[model samples]
Target: MAHAGTVSKHPEGFEDYVKRAKLSMPPEELQGELDYWRSRKVLQRMLDGGLITPDEFHKIDELNRKTFSPKLARLMA
Candidate 1:
């Protein structure tokens, strides 16, 4: 028999690490980080499933960097 929804392996203290990190972030920043991670996962799945070529992935990533760089620099300043 196999267990369902079981995580067999993770780094030690991973949950605690994530909890502390999340607690340290402002709500808006946390939400933005979460959204970014979710989007990356979806993009990876699309790449893996042959839905998008590696060249296309790189192009999209480059476009994202170009699009966001100004906003990110403004936020950093």
Candidate 2:
């Protein structure tokens, strides 16, 4: 079902999700989401290079951005 201000889940690009999620979040939350994505990208690169042990990588990745807020949590997921 459609609702006012709802955006589709099938985002076309990174900015698409940013634009849509921004509508439902405050400035602080939006920034946190951006930070989470940035950190995740770094972690992914480290994994690809085999710089981190798998257990260590999973431990770091398991840290909850949800402890921040819904918007950040969405980005973490």
Candidate 2 lDDT trough over 10 residues, lowest sum:
2-11
TM-score of 1: 0.50
Query: Please, what is the whole-model Cα lDDT of each candidate in the order they appear?
Result: 0.48, 0.57
For each of the candidates, give the backbone clash count. Answer: 0, 0
lDDT of 1 by residue, 42-75 (tens): 6668999999998987777556445433222222
Q: Candidate 2's residue-wise lDDT over 1-77, tens digit each?
A: 32334433332344665765557665555555555555567777898899998787777766734442436345435
- Work out the TM-score per prediction: 0.50, 0.58
Weakest lDDT window of 10 consecutive positions for candidate 1: 68-77
Q: Give the root-mean-square deviation of each candidate in angstroms.
A: 10.2, 9.4
In candidate 2, stretches whose alpha carbon ends up further than 4 angstroms from where it belongs are: 1-13, 19-23, 64-77
